[model samples]
Target: MPNQKKTKIVATLGPATSDKETLKAMILAGVDVFRINFSHANYDDVRERVEMIRALSEELGLYTAILADLQGPKLRVGVMSGEVVVSPGDTITFRTGKPFEGNAEEVYMNYESFPQDVKPGERVLLDDGKLIFEIESTDKKEKVVAKVVQGGPLKSKKGVNLPNTNISLPALTEKDVKDAIFACSLKVDWMALSFVRHSEDLMDLQKLIEEHAEHKIPIIAKIEKPEAVENIDKIVAYCDGLMVARGDLGVEVPAQEVPLIQKRLVIRAKKARIPVIIATQMMETMITSLTPTRAEVNDVANSVMDGADAVMLSGETSVGNYPVQVIEKMTSILKSVEGSELIKVPHDPPQIRTVRYITKSVCYHAALMANEIGAKAISTLTNSGYTAFQISAWRPSAHILVFTSNKAILSQLNLLWGVKAFYYDRFVSTDETIEDVNAIACKKGFLDVGDMLISLAAMPIKDKGMVNTLRVTEIESCPV
Candidate 1:
């Protein structure tokens, strides 16, 4: 049996563990949430899975979160002929023509949209960069004349990679729009956007979500591109969370830099107090084998030590032969790290000398005070869920109960660490807000009668940005 840890574990859902029995087993094995990948599953499948997960959560009396990951614009090369193998010296032409033309001198790309955006000297990589091509020239409105810079065997409909070139592609394609609407309708806890290059990308998606779903869904920016890494601070400020998507990232950037980038991303997100999920290939070998490699175990443990709010399983849970075992293994690894002496290493204290955002600064102060006092729980009354994130950054031992009147805000907090959100009817006054929090604390077993608890809240309970009060109150023996 593994030791139980407070940090959350997110397991991706796939054929191996899509049924109710497997999902329940994973949950019992310590899966804190389930990820539904929209890149593979259709709307109907997602709907069914969501309903099943919801039913199981209720039956087990657990508050497991379901995250819907949107497959953003997937840029892929057009279809090719049967099979063309090119050597390093071989010059292959990528033009628009018949696929069956056995000349083999020129290979045609079936994508009609490729010629409109590609330019001369631009590099195009296919099959995860196994086949590399450099655009030599372009014909007017018809074909792209290219030669294979680095050639290998090319297959049909392989994925394309355009690094650093901003093609005129909509971040949210028609399919993405449809998927977002469906996910929002299903009320998924978190929406992870892929291939986010800039902060405006997140803003545009947010606008689309509002137009289609009529609600503010938390957007998690996937950092898989160099451009995204350059503007990561701004992007993190805008989005609700960040995901270190190392698969495409490794393809786009130098593979050796990935580990450093992962460390940087986790630290940056922690400093910003936004939840960061370490995703992609954390346990790749586990997809086939029941047991994980020693290196994989160390990888997961390192991420936990870095203060990641969650570690995501991609194919390991989605299409793996041992999905449940992989999740269980990850949970065990997290527990081992959590109970080890490494957890006691004092985290670098947050810098408050030059605080710019008052709300963020206040939340940090409140969390520091709570941690210093060794409080059993951190109670926050919030409308936007920022306070909870602030406390989560400290990685305190105390459970965080975020009381919010907005269901949207509550759903967003599902990805955060140690946050147990509860919806409350709009409080008429500040006193009512405190009372409501206390009431919830009692019901949730976080507090007992006559226990001293700390409460932090913004005054008036109506305004959005004022957290200026902290109180220490003794719980009344009887209901007042």
Candidate 2:
């Protein structure tokens, strides 16, 4: 692999790029993480993909992670008779407590509590805000009456969204639970819970993972609902990661608000020291077109300039006509913004009274030291992968070379910004380990003969504790 761009790229795998040749090209094009959306495929299909990704990544000697995005209680329209053309000012009634296929006049909702939860005069959006209706009244019984404000052709099983309704469904649906457990069995590096509304939503998923997963698998709470934005701090503290699911979020909130919301979320995630991914419709134009519109390019550039740890592609790579080309274009944009030195993430100096204050401070100062000295690399020996995130949070320009004995941790670290994880099991004296890693990093082209390096490790390396040691030295300034 060549010198990696600091900002990571994540691409989804789907029918367009299912073959070995396409998958290998995507990995080579710099897809640090491959997301498997559980909504599309069954467990067997998922299992086959997991096997293929691991096999190819190992063969290519590139570190990669897998994120299993669970499809949570997605509210959708139920069986409506063949497509109906709905016009503006048309009246529609959504019926509940009845098992009947609906037609042009009435439709059924998959959510049982839709009638109970929705209030009169609230707006209802269908199919990603294409069709909008203003609720006139809800009987709080079997039906709700609505008038179409913006109308289009209605398709069966289209998604439903009530931006104002207080939905009663748990963050994780029954299918989500089953999918999560299966993903745990496969030992995916990350799990994303969709439509997170509160901190407790993450807690529920966390508890479930703790019970079933053999090892720690970090959870990324999908920030789509307006309630999730309100509880950002709590959500950041409790979850392992955050993803701005902008497709649904942009529809739920006023469209004008999503840009600032996205920027705020990035700043908060940077402060929290957990990876943040900006996802959804990043390169939607590239889904069918040969090239992206300039607006789409600017969107990717802005995300990178906002200090987003990663930018994710959905339809462009999943079901689109051009999958590998999308990844290549996304990589081009990420590298352009990152090379321009425009990203300035707000640095939160480590605080006192924190349990891991010392470790945090070491990672913080390491970034400062690297910047002041113009170090080529910041190398750390980590057992639990804590120091990598801590160092990445400070937005250091140096290449983050993480040396870990755990191969699983190596792949998992692929999601962090500026990270390039390597494997090393030899934990002798601190100096010996430092020399070994410096040599490896040099061989890997992350360092030059006279380049400065910042090394961090825990004292008494055999214990493999949190990072507590930092050293700066020139790598091979003179022939040994």
Candidate 3:
């Protein structure tokens, strides 16, 4: 509706976008979602930023969604003395739950069960697989001895990835529980659980939210662990959304396998009718350089062609010098791909045996009819946002214009592909409500005189039941 690309862009909020002016510019540049990563954020700063984003969204008259990304059981090394170097054939010792000056030979780790969980021959990768170590032995008390297989300069508090060992840590840690509660208090539109091992992890998080929050927020499962990749089908069906967290996933498995894994996850999510995002290092080279590497540009383009709902940027937006420029460039790439036949995503037919088959069929046909007649938009009245997600999954040529009275859902649909949500109440007569939304659409410039609009809504509109009505209207002109 805003002349934007169908594939949304999600930018991580940080020092680069802390200023109000920069954030507004990003919104204008088509950043549909702002992600607040709780992994290394200061709570006070996060609260302040959330306040600013909501205030600015009202001021700018643009709908924006906020995603609270919970840091789940992220293991790391303790503070080092300063920095040390190691080479192949070097030996290092990591002791758990003890204060010690970190050095080349010995360092402290935060995870208390590291020594108990690690075993001989398991590989340990640090600093995003920059340094690799093979476990030699562990005392099973407090010490783990490893030999450097691939080494580099090690520093304090570097991320540790145990690719070969199954560390026994709950998907939601104590910190994550507190963070989820805080995020609910902020009324963020979406919550993403990092390092989600399986679908049960989402149930664990939902239980926590149901206990503390007034409403249940939609969640996105971060598929970063090998276990999550293996359990992707269940995870896709259970969670509201999915994110292919390639950074940690590539470290967990071979880097060469991540591309295929990302494609597979996207397909599963699409079939389940859930939004899936492609994240991590999408435009890493643009962090400092004004332009992205050829490979980086190609990566974002491929994600769009693969039918991802959104593409996310991490350090490139949070700590990069060219945050706004990076978004502009990403948008340019998206538009280029979206204009081509390559962006045609697969369509999933409804299962007649499913209980909701009729609703799904209505949504599917709405999209199909809209495309057949070259309609300008597919308008739908949805309270639960179910039809919006359903129609969006079809990847229709026409934009999915969603009219809803649910205030929380207005922002939630922003992450959906090809969906533009509007806050609409006053469900009067079916004809009157349809006219009301059509007028709003024309005023917003998505439709003009003589444009064909395919609209769907439930009959007896006040009942607010499942979508059961479909109509095609020709927009002549709205009264002054």
Which candidate number maximizes lDDT? Answer: 3
Model 2 vs. true fold: TM: 0.97
* Model 1 TM: 0.85
Q: How accurate is candidate 1 locally (lDDT)?
A: 0.77
Which ten contiguous residues of candidate 2 have the minimum total lDDT?
339-348
Give me the displacement of residue 212 in model 3, in angstroms: 1.8
All candidates: CA RMSD (Å): 4.0, 1.6, 1.3
lDDT of 2: 0.89
Clashing pairs in 3: none
Q: Write the per-residue lDDT of candidate 3 for residues 150-236, one digit (tens) a residue.
A: 988998888999988888999899999999999999888999999998788899999988887776699999999898988888887
lDDT-better candidate, 2 vs 3: 3
Q: How accurate locally, in lDDT, is each candidate?
A: 0.77, 0.89, 0.90
CA deviation > 4 Å runs, candidate 1 = 1-4, 79-83, 96-113, 119-121, 339-359, 423-453, 458-466, 472-480
Model 2, residue 320: distance off in Å is 1.4
Q: Candidate 3, after superposition: displacement of residue 246 in Å?
A: 0.9
Each candidate structure's TM-score, on Cα atoms with residue i matched to residue i, is: 0.85, 0.97, 0.98
Candidates 1 and 3 compared: the better one by TM-score is 3
